[model samples]
Target chain A: MIGLRALATGDALPQVKPEVMRMYNMRFCPFAQRTRMVLLYKEIPHEVVNVNLRRKPKWLFERNPFGLVPVLEYNNEIVYESSICDDYLDELYVERPLYPKDPHRKAHCRVVMAKYDKMVPSFYKLIKPDENLRLQAKETISEEMKSLEIELGDGAFFGGPQPNMIDFHVYPWFERLTALKSIVEFDILQENNLHRLQLWQKRIEKLTCVKETMQPKEWHLEFFIGLANKNPQYDIGLPQSKV
Target chain B: MIGLRALATGDALPQVKPEVMRMYNMRFCPFAQRTRMVLLYKEIPHEVVNVNLRRKPKWLFERNPFGLVPVLEYNNEIVYESSICDDYLDELYVERPLYPKDPHRKAHCRVVMAKYDKMVPSFYKLIKPDENLRLQAKETISEEMKSLEIELGDGAFFGGPQPNMIDFHVYPWFERLTALKSIVEFDILQENNLHRLQLWQKRIEKLTCVKETMQPKEWHLEFFIGLANKNPQYDIGLPQSKV
Candidate 1:
């Protein structure tokens, strides 16, 4: 479903039959990947329409004024923001509930998600041009991993036995950690005493939902490399041999 | 219930009886006001313990790792972040449901909340040191008001007829607009064509919850002025005659 190339400026809107849910997405966006993982995990029937971020289509703005990916359109109504989109999906499709049922536990999940949101900038900081800043970010990330390792404790996932919304919310960044490590040349997980987080990552990597929604590490590397060079390849993986 | 002064460094933690909900708060924090409004609206029995933000209590960090206000402690479990705390409260005390029952409508409320969150920084930008940036931020805020006005369109509240979670989520910022206007020497609502939002603000101002939790505009002006001067009075309205 994800092989389709991203549509840039002036591209005509893709047609979608009424009643079919559609997600306006960017193929490699970690934020978009959160919703994608949720969609796959729930087996919700949906259509994916990738939009080029740099030269975004006009219609994409119509769907989400922020022009950010992971916007969900269903019954002619739209919901933007990746976490909100995932929550919306989980609420609508209750067969495989991703969030905890207890209010306290569910609130705990939200708290963990908020913490993950704060920690994300550190991962991005690792790719900064300044050496000192990159080193500082690496140190920050290692500290974060140690904390997370303690949080993981004896659980296989943040959700204890299986991955929950919190797991899906945080997993995309963990996946990108490798690509970031490739650029920074620092193995954060290995260098830190984060045995539980390391094991948790391994368990997450084996999930079918993760397998179906994740892009290759090389693809992430190429995308980030392009971004660092200031010429982001929004349509990185599409075949262009014929052209 | 809010008359108590803020506790600073070395201040002892207030004793909270078992099963009683406690909120770690700051008197003038708009973020904390959201949860305060909800607790009032739902008539939830909770204790308020204000913390001086600049010289925070060590126990405050123990309650919320970020050391941010609006942390809820119930049953020995803590939930930080205003939005999440409100959501948790709403879920637990469902008598007067703050969210819509329909999934799509609820998601729409969330989208609006996200937009409000994005718009909030511009309000703070009005107090920046750079004149050009402040002017730009004012313009941005005016444009944001126009968009919000359109979204409000003919509805009494964003939740339609009655205030909901979305209203509480956004109302705190609107409450502070007057103080911001005073500091910037600009009346955004009067200058801009945002009749609906203006009317909505008036309506929100009249709510019992709003009246109960809100500080006077003069207090907000004082707090914000103190903030701009790099010396915030976290205990602004407290009596100093005894000392």
Candidate 2:
């Protein structure tokens, strides 16, 4: 334990050079993927422990009372909220910056983050079908995609010239739409004027860093498709790999 | 906007000279209120602008694409995400610091913050009058309340001996439970393990700072009651303060 005084005055970000952060995570969680994306971007080496939500590791329960994953364990500084972890990493590592340095740009970045978080709850509603939520998700995805189109405009990634923290934070979830396009029906790309979104998706996944960090796992994609297809009301089209 | 370099290098905390933060807020939003609670706790003052969500101010919309209340504009820095704003203020403000200085305690603080953000979505589902959802809300709320109790166990606030950022973040939403108790059939206060939770709620509210920053207005409570009434499937009893 240290006071603000104990922390080195000249140094910012966590100055204590410790081993790589011990990451508590799983492959399927997009939230966890967001953190992993940061690690890949920062080039921060860390031990990754995958946990089965069904039978969570005891250490997980000990470290995380809430019983959730994607917890980062550094020397002593542990951070939560995948996006917060991303921000913290950006602060600590300046070599490859992710967040925008402008306030309006930062707030714009948050809107994209909000778009991703908003998708989860309604998206889960489709795990079991009901007209209102299915219709609601359709409308939301449509509007969100449209919003993303304008937000992205002519930008290569969500970030203008290069992928930044916002790109890594939101792109993985959008990748799910690509994987399960056929399983759920919505003209999100169409209605949202987001043809650019699909293009950007391809660009992000093909990044040398991103490609090095990951490979296509057909099972995970298939699983979401299976989940989407199980519902009676959804007539999501067959899978489309825009990427 | 300040660079990550400026953000880290600033002798922000514990320095007598305070950094001013401009806050766009709404008194009634539990999310927005969390920021005010932290500002008051840290003893930092800022210019506050009230935003109407339905009719969002153009400045806010232009400034914050998400346009959510409690947008903190500091030293040419614009930070969104309520939890971000809370932690940022603590990091930047010079007096009455509310964050735990210890790394482990900081991790624990984040665990609690992450839990709050994660639980909020599901809990919002409770407003809809669906049998499964209502049950889930109660179950989820009860579960979180239990966690809060253990976290607070014989301690005053989330950070022992002080009502830190997470405590302020959680309390305003839990206060809504008080309003909902009037409508829902469950007695969260009377539950077996919630006795400590009930005690903590009262203890935190007694803080002069919290009391000043948050108060239950008759209509706002009615607004929540009205929100709860949106789902008509289940029977609810709303005690109308004005009528």
Candidate 3:
């Protein structure tokens, strides 16, 4: 129930209740998924308004000038950027805090997220048409994975006992690891005997919040491969009329 | 006295007191200047350990694996990244909060920072050796300036009455704007008649914290231009001792 569906061009905007929150999202966007995971994990009362990114509505632009998902609208105020949205929500609804209560630990959490962020470009590079660039990106990804292994360093989660911002922030990239391996002929996660990283991935996969929000491996592979090939109709066949 | 000078390969590391803080910094790094400004703003007693970036010390790498400057060592715990360090310090010393108290306003402040964050690459593009790329960057910067002008929109500061994280986060770029303009023959601030932005620049420049931390405009111009020219001796003139 927490996962994505589709949106079409002619679909009417969802009715917003005074108490409920709404998020403008794309079905296949990893950035949007990060917010979705946070919302579902917190069990917040929210509606997802999936936008057909290929034909984004004018209202979507009105909501977020950058036209990015998942922009959260709460109490008639809108906020965007996945990290910012998540941070705002965590601060507003502080029951199960996504960040550490200790200031030093929280600061260290941000550094961990930043360290993982360096690998993002290489993940995108896996889909490029240039094989040379793809190979170079593979090397970069491998190097970055080694760094991640060191950071993990026998920990169950980057969030320590439970998943926090760092866990959720970086998990989206791993969701596509299967697709990246299939398309690029190698998997950085599998290669270096990254024992801690592999175990960390498994731990993330077993989480109920992740289970509800994540699409299957095949689904991710197909979706991303379609994106890599620049396919236009890749997101069709969902219940568009309802979304 | 909270400003930068030069450091050389053999410079001795500043002796750290039992309780005082120490910051590893570079004379001309805009990123490092951000943390320096924050330290000065908060009136925190800290010693500056100038790192000869051309020849970073082994201890520097031990402090931070990424070997970046603006590393803060407080209570024997090391923290790096300008924003993270500033946020940690602000949270630790709560007398003057860097972000707004209201969640909505804080989120808006983050968006303001993110918007300015997108313009950074274009600023660097002004220094690109390729004329066509430089021209393209100029256009991008102009467009981004129009966006900033819209964001500022009659406010004294991005956070309303006073400067906040957004102001400090984006001010370092303006500190080097004169250099960027002198080298590129264009001024994004002056070109669009960005009155608010220009006023904001003057206001930030006048802040005692900024005044204490900022290098002379001529110094910034010479250093950045030297960097753009790939000059290795730009950071020379300090005693070549053990850092």
Models ranked on DockQ = 1, 3, 2
Candidate 3 clashes between residue pairs 3 or more apart in a chain or in different chains:
B10-B241, B10-B242, B11-B241, B11-B242
- Report how far residue B22 has shifted in candidate 2, in Å: 6.8
Candidate 1: clashing pairs of residues: none
lDDT of 1 by residue, B87-149 (tens): 999999998899998889899989988887887888888888999988888888788778778
Count of clashes, each model: 0, 6, 4
Q: Judge the docking of candidate 2 as incorrect, acceptable, medium or high.
A: incorrect
Worst 10 residues of 3 chain B by lDDT: B234-243
Give the DockQ (2 decimals) of all models: 0.91, 0.15, 0.67
Which residue pairs clash in candidate 2?
A146-A192, A182-A236, A182-A237, A182-A238, A184-A236, A185-A236
lDDT per model vs. reference: 0.85, 0.64, 0.77
lDDT of 1 by residue, A133-196 (tens): 8888787777767777777779988878877888898888788887667667778888885778
Among all windows of 10 consecutive residues in model 1 chain B, the one with the lowest summed lDDT is: B234-243
Ranking by lDDT: 1, 3, 2
lDDT, residue B113, candidate 3: 76
Question: Which is better, 1 or 3, measured by lDDT?
Answer: 1
